[model samples]
Target: MSERVVRPVGRGFLFLDSHPAGCAAVVRRMAAEVEPRTPERRTALVVGSSSGYGLAATIAGLARYGVDGIGVSFEKAATARRTATAGWYRTAETAALATELGRSWTFVNADAYADTTKDDVLDLIAGKLGKIDHLIYSVAAPRRVDPRNGETYQSALKAIGAPHTTKSLAFDDGVPVLQEVGIDVATDDEIAQTVKVMGGEDWARWITALQDRDLLEPGFSTVALTYIGSELTGPLYRQGSIGAAKADLEQTALNLAKDGVTAMTSVNGAAVTQASSAIPGIGLYVSLLHKVTALQTPVEQSIALWDQLTGETPLDLDDEGRIRLDRWELTDDVQSAVRAQWESATQDNIAEVADAAWFLAEVRRLYGFDVPGVDYTAETEVDVEWPTTA
Candidate 1:
């Protein structure tokens, strides 16, 4: 068979953000090129392991850094429609890749919002590794199951106005058409329900359960992802129910430290993962951030997280222990620029400001499939393996 040389220029294709491989790429770059680490396999527990930053962190912990990890997620192998969600396929593919690289990858399709998930993980750790050295919390879900009552609590994202309009490229035509988005005025009870579902409650539960099981070892560090963006995303994210949940997460990090998981922390990282896309008004912000950052910083310089947790390079600290990924992007200067441009942006001005078209393409490329010249039309099945209980 003649080898098909498909050189992927960078991250995923526009509009399609493949969380798994994009995450894997980030981890590989961070571990090897950006923040280098000592090469010894360690045991890790990664919740939300099938998607978004959680998946990326998992890839870094397992594949790139060669850490053995147990991933806890409710990622269905196939979505309700029987088609693979981006996260489901990505996680499955990533687990296979990690196995080939000699790293253990366990994927548990249990809800992270459950008490039993942690319990089961601890049981596995006891049988195989006996302890978890590092824990990474990266769960992004629109709802949660009450492990207490088994009631499903769903969350809502605040959309702009009664029904606001935004621009998205019609895949068939590259033209940016204004898309109208609906606002779901979540009730007060709904807000509370959302918070309980997405907030730090589940995080605390996980930590407590692991501690009760004595699965967390000394020097055990943990970090949960958070995002506090500028005014643009306030209605949809920062001031929304999800934002409130994130605030709770940030607070939980401090409590985790005070309680002796001193190495535990929270990361308010960059704004592009799958989780961000679900939020309203984020596409514009992300497009702007990517555009401006690319101009202000070189591609390698844009490798923000690489310099933080991984001991590869010197650390860059913010006022808090949290990494300043979106903070800088959402700064007064940057946000102002983006806000002004967003106000005046017409389809004609897209290429000038930040191509929403390009944004979609990059997101699609994360699936490990294509760039313009890369052909994946034929089925190429690579036998994949996943961690089994150990």
Candidate 2:
């Protein structure tokens, strides 16, 4: 059994106020970047909108911009025996809370890689919200079925040419056990498949489909989130199969720009998320990285990035036209300190060099656990309804 809490909330009540309270702080800062919106004419669409940056963007859109949005995510609901995915609860809570505050939102649960999902989303946007003014692509999946051919492509997380060995941690008998793990290199075919699954294909498809239907509003903007870590984890991330996908995504952004919408990739610092936890060697790397950098949470970073993208600055972009939000994580001093810790890290010393307890708490928070003010002992409503529109 996996040691991590995949389902943190059982039949217990989840404190609803803390999440929006946390989001509101980020929104107050984000308000500085948001131009006053003339409501009733704006709509936003977010793919993979149930969690992480997507969820944050959704909340910011509602709370900061007061924009109506249609969100698409594939998350399973709770059952009698099995707990629901955290995203499900988060989405429900977000919708319920936003509605109480006079916001309009809709969540479509569907696979983003499917043409059918895109079609359904376009219909929702056309019917409920009119046209989309902003689109956010934040889907992180290991496998994708090509909508054109129905062939499945799976992504891999590995070095390109050689195996990278590192000291890692895993839960054994409910105790943290340190061990040495070697991740092998990816073959050429594997690399290609990984790129195919994880790259910008689906994003382009959604944009083009919207364009064909004349659903994208004039001056629309879209962004996809990516990550590029330090050299220590390059083999597993920045120079690996997923990196290839991100490079292709960057190219796709350039192409999309030609079609008149602002499209770009925002590189973010590593954080503990459901998708990220599955990446090999990332747990140890992120723990040490956090200790050295003291990086902000994803929601904080998302608000900052949104400010840059939507503020009067006209979307600051690098030479490659991509947003660089990982500056803090890649600073010379932070990387140097992290490198030093990496060199000294061992099974016995990892706990000392890295804030292991903080890392665990952060991971738990992702699944709606360990939040400081949330009363876990309270009785929760397992059948919370999606918030209704105004």
Candidate 2, backbone clash total: 3
Model 2 spans with C-alpha error above 4 angstroms:
1-41, 173-176, 386-390
User: What is candidate 2's lDDT per residue for 35-140, written digit by digit as tens?
Assistant: 4333444578889888777876776666655768888888766555454566776776667656765777888878999999888888888888788888889988
* lDDT (C-alpha, whole model) for all candidates: 0.60, 0.72
Candidate 1 at 68: error in angstroms? 2.4
Question: Per-prediction RMSD in angstroms?
Answer: 5.5, 5.2
Which 10-residue window of candidate 2 scores lowest in summed lDDT? 10-19
Q: lDDT of model 1 at residue 6? A: 30
Model 1: which ten-residue window has the lowest total lDDT?
1-10
